[model samples]
Target: MHQETRLLIGQISDTHIRPKGQRYHGVADSNRMLAQAIAHLQGLDRRPDLVLLTGDLVDKGHPDEYAMARELLAELAIPCLVVPGNHDHRDAFRAAFADHAWLPAAGPLHFCVDTHPVRIVALDSTVPGAHHGAIDEAGLDWLHTTLAADRAKPTLVVLHHPPFASGIPYMDGYALRAPERLAQVIGAFDNVERVLCGHVHRLMLRRWAGTVVCSCPSTTTEIALRLQPDARPASFMAPPACMLHLWSAADGMVSHLSTIGDFEGPFDFA
Candidate 1:
């Protein structure tokens, strides 16, 4: 029998940090929001074992923006794993986060991290020079081989683009290409606990191919929720948030959203 193990993971996505002193649009400051979120993560009763930054680390993928991001992220006490989003430049991202040896020097950034309770497989869904996401044959083969390598451990797949189409029309247009292929790959593994994604800039949860797919909202601005046919493309400064994925053998993996901000708390439960 697999001994019950508990692991807590923190995920913050779409940081979209601009150069120092620059704001994301004229309003939202990615750095400030990220700092607050980090403070909140650290303040949790139990700290996470690892923090995953699911892409879009910078607004323009510029060196200066990456420098600012690196500096802000340095406050984290746990191991931080990163993947590239559509807004990211592969070379710039790799260079900026060079300490992460798991990142390939110059290719699709797909790798797996073996941690206590789950095997985290981060897939590179960003296609070069494109906004939409795709996992080519090679990426799929890599995923299959990686998952098959060890079947006992529970798995968590992370990517920038979600495989399922969200009701938000504009974002849906850029949804992951050929999702059926991803489905097939995920379906092959019964131990996969969840697929965590970011990019839509909203918090959403759905089940795709028997696995839960959850998209984390951005730490900057959020895409306006317009599910109607006539809805126009717009973004709103909705409450910035991140997710905490907790795992244990008995309860499996459960995800919770931690909205960034100071809130009144804990009076005695008596």
Candidate 2:
């Protein structure tokens, strides 16, 4: 049997879903936005082969919120992989998403998903009792050993925190601690095609460690683009979106942003 060479991955992050009928920060309706995102994905011409919920699955570490997030995500037609963020409770997340075979029964929720044309390495960067992210020694060792085992496969490293600092001051303050460690591991691996992340609540693309690191925008709120000292982070109702990563034998890997919601389109240039 011949394997499919082309692959499409849908990535949604920073959902921040609150308990039923509740809004994020008392304004953004996360549940409604997530539903719209799911509907849009369902109607896409070429549906994604798999979906990844990068992190921040809920606003608070509550059982009800995890239940709600899990319920909403269950609507997707394709397989979904998940990781926990600073705002998430690992135990609750594991319980809610136990059906995913990649998820472990305990410890850091890290695993590898092998699909045609690409392999995804989901890293757990959340630190207990802290908003900032870290990979710790054990996680780093695991990452190093994992990448070394299969050096030929095209890999996409998924994590909740942005390894590098974004220009936005307030958001940068919450960046991953000692990112150089993560950088060293990735730098050693030439097969890593991209690093996909969430938690920044905005779309960011850049070249790091000889590979591309792209952060997906939140499905709930858009973070303010304030690039200055003492700039406070704020989210607005700009637009909810997800990242589409396409990979093939010929083209390698490329990503595009799929903005969710009603819009005008199909205008021809003829």
Candidate 3:
């Protein structure tokens, strides 16, 4: 695959679907909001080859919520890959997206390694009843062993939480606990091209452990891009967004942020 290649992927995250088809985090019109996102993806000129539901597939680990989310994702023509989030119950997520084998042993994590030109290692970093994050020693070892096998492969490490701070005070507390260990593993691997995650409920791009890392905004709601903490949590905005990641064997990676509505922003740079 070259940079000009058309292997595009769509990314949706932090949906937080409610059991009664209720709004998530108090964001109104949850189903409509999600539907809007799907419509957006469908309208893309070059439809994505695949779609990744990067975590927070539901609000609670309830069966009904999973059912709702499952049906929602099934509407997409492409494969929708999922992993568990802190709010997601592993069993429910697996039961919902049952076709994708979660892990070798019974665990809440989903670690999928894409072995194409770019290797994507998806790790399940959810901890039940806990907001903070960490990949256990076993997960770390798995990452290490996987990375060790391929020295020249370009890799993308996808997970639920940001391994570092996004500077949002409230969300910062939930930052990956014991991130240094994870950093060490990342440090050891030179083949890592980037890392993608989706817990902040906002769009962000920054560097971590010498790799490009970013979070795609929610398909339903978004956390405000606050440089400083705000008393009231920021919520819904128009043009619910997802990301289009273009990875290639020759050109590395390029990205585009996809929106649900029209745009007029090629304005004069006056």
lDDT of 3 by residue, 136-170 (tens): 99999988887887878778788899888888877
Clashing pairs in 3: none
Estimate, for each residue in 218-259, the C-alpha lDDT of model 2 and write its tens digit.
999889999989887677898899999999988898899999
Per-residue lDDT over 1-270 for candidate 1, one digit per residue giving the tens place of the 0 to 100 score: 866678999999999998889899878988899898899889999999889999898888899999999899889888889989999988898899788888877789999998566899999999878899999999999999999998878999899999988988989888899999999999888899999999999889998878899999999889998899778999988888899999988899899998888767767775
Per-model TM-score on C-alpha atoms: 0.96, 0.96, 0.89
Give me the runs in candidate 2 sitting further than 4 Å from their true place. 1-4
Off by over 4 Å in 3: 1-6, 102-105, 229-232, 263-270
**What are the lDDT figures for the candidates, one per model?**
0.90, 0.90, 0.77
Clashes (candidate 1): 0
Determine the backbone clash count of candidate 3: 0
Question: Comparing 2 and 3 by lDDT, which wins?
Answer: 2
